[model samples]
Target: MILEPKMIEEVQAAVQEAKCLGVRGQGTKPALAMAWGETAVLSTRHLSGILAYEPNEYTFTAYAGTAVSEVITTLAQNNQYLPFDPLWVEAGATLGGTVAANASGSGRYRYGGVRDFILGVSFVDGSGQLVRGGGKVVKNSAGFDIPKFMVGSLGRYGILVELTFKVFPKPRSYVTLQLQYASLHAALFAMFKLAVMPFEMDVLDLAPELAGKATLIIRLGGLPEALPGRVERMRGFLQEQTEVETAVLLENEADITYWQAQNRFDWAFAASQLVKIPVTPKQIPTLDKHLTNTLRRYSAGGNVAWVAADDMTALQTTLTELNLAGLQFTGHTDDPYLGSRKGRRFAQRIKKALDPNAVFSTND
Candidate 1:
């Protein structure tokens, strides 16, 4: 059965009653929601709306169940946005769900991810007790830092009721430069070179092209008058200093549409399974070798890989061989986690303390 709580008290009551509860928002992540097994589902959809938004103060508090799309629209009106670029907003991803999953988009290359922007959170613990952490301001430095701890917690500790996040002023203009490389090795070499150079990139991504080639996508955001010159300089530098086969400049609508599709994961729309693996650029060459058949994109300068695969078993085996782990967001499986599991001992200790009664399903 599913319970939709419209108020804090209602959420608490639902939590207290369920022996095994699965917390969810709008069910944007079906695979994750399915991992809960036969447990009772607690939907936060009804408990939605912005509690407070202070554009001048650069922070906003909203019910966890509130849609991220709503927050983005509201922030856009004020010329401010969440720097982490919360993902799945176009598919009705909720603020709390994004926090629970720790999902961020390409822009995370600049300002950081969900954990970096979250200021505070209010949640109902496993025992149905209301708990609060952090504050609704940017300079908060007190308590157990529970807000950060809750990130990627996946509702194992508590059900988030409200969330607060800091925002930044939206950039006035943007451009993307697509640099082509003859091979993955060459592309990664260029990325390492670009990393040390003095360029403020808003997004850095790499994708495979035909014939074993690769494309390096770089986004620059700033004043409109200054963008053309910046793009030219960056493009010229890549042409002269790196093994770039071609450099194409994308601007205005083309730039916007390209990034929007990327952030939305449109390329993975047809895949049966979608998994996120944390990785470094140094490991990409080896990982790429094993994922030739999979649709993959390396984002945030190769700090993360989003893989869309048809063969979960083979993919899991490959990740295990590499000593890497992946968090599955789509497709069917007995477990949402693939390959090597990390930090289980520490997580178990925290889970015991927060949800001693095991009211929240851990899917372990």
Candidate 2:
């Protein structure tokens, strides 16, 4: 059954009785929230609203159930936005679920991810007690910084009720470039070089084309008057330093469409199973060599990859063999996460401390 609690007290009361509570928000990633089989669904739908927003302070607090689009809309009105570009779920994702999944988009290439922007949170622990961590203000960095620990906890420790995040002013102008390469190695070699450069890229991605061809898309955000000069300078640098065959600057609507499409993983989601794999620039060549058959896109300047594969077992086996971390976003998996065992042990310690009763489920 779905239990929607309107307030913290009600949430506590609901959690007090459930043998296990599968935290849910808008039911966007059902594979996560409902993967626990017979457990009761504790939805944050009713406990949604903006608690506080201070544009001048560059911070905002909203209920766990608040729609990400709603927060973005509010920030847009004031020329401010979440730098992390929280992944937008087509099934109407909520901010809480986004954080729980630790889903950040291509925009994170410049600034950071949800963990970096999150300043504080108010959650109901497994013990049915309300716990607050960090603070609403940016400078308030006192104590354990438990707020960030929740960034990718997947609601196993607690149910996030209220969340606070640091936001940034939107860029004045944006310039997008399509850099085409003759091969995957050539494209990734350029991507690695770009990663260490001084130029700030708002978004960077690489997608494979047919017949050993690949394309690297770079987005630059800055003042309108300075953008053209910066774009030309970067183009020249890439041409001189890397084996880039061609570079074309995207204009207007096409740029927006391409950027948005990357954020949503439009190509990967079309397949039967969609997976997000985390890999560093140094690992891209090796990872790409193994994933050539899959429809994939390398994002965050080659720090992560999103792939669409029909065989879950093969994908898991491949990831295991490569020693690359991956998380299945769609379809069934024995375990959605393929992170290191050391990381899992650390998570287990936190889980024990925050959820002694084992109230929340982590199964996929």
Candidate 3:
């Protein structure tokens, strides 16, 4: 049933009768929406609209059902942005869904992930109790840091009702450079070198190029007047230190389109099983060896790899062998996650306290 609760009373009533509930938002991520089958669906689709926004304070509180695109559009109007750059794989994606999944795009390379920017959240527990956690501003919380734990929770503990986020000022201009390398090995080597440098990059991604080659795309944002010099310096360093076949500093529409297409994966893998894999730059080349036939790109400065492969069994086996974890965005899987646990003990403790009756399915 659509849990379009206009107030806390409505939410309590909705949860009161359900034995097992599958908390959902827009169902943009099909795999996650149906992760737990046979459970009653409790959609946050009705709890829409921004509750509060203070552009001057760089913070905003929105209902859980608010569309991510809506939040982004509002923030952009004030020369501010959610630094985490919530992943928008599908158009109807909600802010709550993105937080629950802990999905971020290439922009997270500079600052951090969704957990870093989240200030607080309000949710409904299994007992139909309205609860809140974290603080409204970017300061210490009054109670437990439950909001941070909610990241990647997949709606296991409770159903998120509202969320508050810390925003950042957008840069005046952006510049992107495409550096072509002979092979993935060379491209990754250059990525490692750039990672340790003092230069601040907005986005860093490595993708396949023509003839089995590789391309390293670097995006820098700042004052329009200062970007030209920074771009020249970066270009000079790469030319002198690495074997770059070509260096092209993109401007205007070209730069915008490249980054947009990267996040949307609109290149070649439009019809393949897409998965997000967590790996270090050192592990990228190794993963690339197994994914030779897949269309893939390393995002977040090589910390995350987005791969599109047709064979699920092969992909899962490869991930198991490499000792890496993966979250398949699309496709069927008995277990959606293929990775080691993080904070399992702590998560279990919180889950027990918040959902004592197991009314919600975590799909763990």
TM-score of every model versus the real structure? 0.96, 0.94, 0.93
lDDT of 2 by residue, 213-256 (tens): 99998999878899998998888899889888877888668877
What C-alpha lDDT, on a 0 to 100 scale, does residue 75 get in candidate 1?
96
**Candidate 3, overall lDDT?**
0.82
Off by over 4 Å in 3: 1-3, 136-144, 209-211, 339-346
**1-364, model 3: which lDDT tens digit per residue?**
5456666677788788888888778887766777475457888877889989999999999998899889888998999988887776446789889999888988999999999999999888999998878774434445457788788888888888889998999988898999999998888888888988988999888987536789998999999999999988888888777899987888878887877776666764656767889888888877888878788888998999888878878887888888788887766555567655556687788788889888887654
Cα displacement (Å) at residue 336, model 3: 1.9
Backbone collisions counted per model: 0, 0, 0
Candidate 1 deviant stretches above 4 angstroms: 136-143
Best by TM-score: 1
C-alpha root-mean-square deviation, each candidate: 1.7, 2.1, 2.2
Candidate 1 residue-wise lDDT, 1-364, digit = tens? 8889999999999888878898889888777777356468998988999999999999999999999999999999999988898888888999999999998999999889999999999999999999888884433355468889999998999999999999999998899999899998888988888888888999888988537899999999999999988888887888887878877888999998987888778888565688999999999999999888678899999999999988888989999999999999877766789988889898999899889998998865
For candidate 2, report its TM-score: 0.94
Each model's lDDT comes to 0.88, 0.82, 0.82
